[model samples]
Target: MNKPANHDERMAKMTFGSVYPHYVIKVEKKGRSKAELHEVITWLTGFDDEKIESLINDKVTFEQFFEQANLHPNAPSIKGMICGYRIEEIDNPLTQKVRYLDKLVDELAKGRKMEKILRTE
Candidate 1:
């Protein structure tokens, strides 16, 4: 049986696997934490959730998972060894996460305030 188009769309909509293919991520040039860097970068890649699940389930290799992903792109401000995404333009996952967290927190605060009012009434 063939999966529905929705399956692909669902996958496309997923954030864990959705990588910002065109962002520039630069870690400290002198950082020697390859393992840490790899771990951090993996989550930001598209299909991150799927890839992470596969890693846990033993379905794919790390290289294959992030095959299209890139390291931090070069930054013009500083002059030193640098690495980041190599795409023309991409959104940064960190920024997205921050925005999401902020929104979530605001929602929770509103909920809490509502709860307090309800409790008093």
Candidate 2:
């Protein structure tokens, strides 16, 4: 899965803040609450509401966001297709993490139970 030469750089430069609203809208349109979205994010990144707000306010890049994240150990369990790529097959670690978030948000929008979305047995 060789990405374009500039893809990684572009993704690195894209601010998490820029994409936050889209995630919010995606879930909200499906009758999901913002709290649920935050919970999913916290489960993956270990960032609480305050830190997430700060990151959004500061316009942190995905690179910086993931760099500061204490990524959940269960993150590897997240699998499926997102944005035309398979999560487990993504060659780029950063891209994979980004897609993992996308996949979780997609699940939430699809009304998957929180327990399953969190991958808790």
Candidate 3:
């Protein structure tokens, strides 16, 4: 009496990995509010931008460093993390084009393969 999660095992336990390689870092917390979403995901996964400004200038909050990173739920209040890379490889966006802050950053910056950036319409 416990079987519930089924959709790809609840999306691999919240976007951790079935493959490894998902890097999407679109953080715009509306009005800034001292924005520090885990230093914008360690500066878009490249890291070492002075260690994301010395770990977000020493305040550290974006839910205590992204709650150990690797997140999911890009809707019901917005979430989409893997803030380092994994959930199936990174850096996409229909190979590159679609703009206008891109619909959900092109669905988490083009994983699920983007499919011409989700039909762009």
Candidate 4:
């Protein structure tokens, strides 16, 4: 009955705030706005602007961030590869959710329309 190894440790050690700046830079370089990035994140994780600000300011770990988030109903609609992994095929639920966000941001950075990224179209 031993717990799994450092999977949680790795995920927990990554603070969302630590990564936010990179995301901003990536999208901005491609002529996208920070507001669009925020919108995609909020849509996926169900965190509002205020809550997201608080989470970033607090340096919350990915674990805590996902724990508090009420994932959107359409999250499963997000699919495709990110960082070489097929998001929908990831077996770990937490890992899949993380990759889902990454995929969305990648799409945004690539200049995909918000409606398409959100799967609303």
Query: Each model's C-alpha lDDT?
Result: 0.32, 0.95, 0.31, 0.86
Over 1-121, each residue of candidate 2 has an lDDT whose tens digit, in order, gives: 4568898788888999999999999999999999999999999999999999999999999999999999999999999888888899988899889999999999999999999999997
Model 2 regions lying over 4 Å from their true place: none
Candidate 1 lDDT over residue span 1-121, tens digit each: 2335454334334353233221112222333233333333442343354445554355433334334444223211112111232222224433333233223223233333423212222
The model with the greater TM-score, 1 or 2, is: 2
Number of backbone collisions per candidate, in order?
Answer: 19, 0, 4, 0
* Model 4 ranges with Cα > 4 A deviation: 1-8
Pairs clashing within candidate 2: none
For candidate 3, the C-alpha RMSD (Å) to the true structure equals 14.0
Best by lDDT: 2
In model 4, what lDDT does residue 79 have? 86
lDDT: worst 10-residue window of model 4: 1-10
Better TM-score candidate (2, 4): 2
TM-score of each: 0.20, 0.96, 0.19, 0.90
Instruction: Find the number of clashing residue pairs for candidate 2.
Output: 0
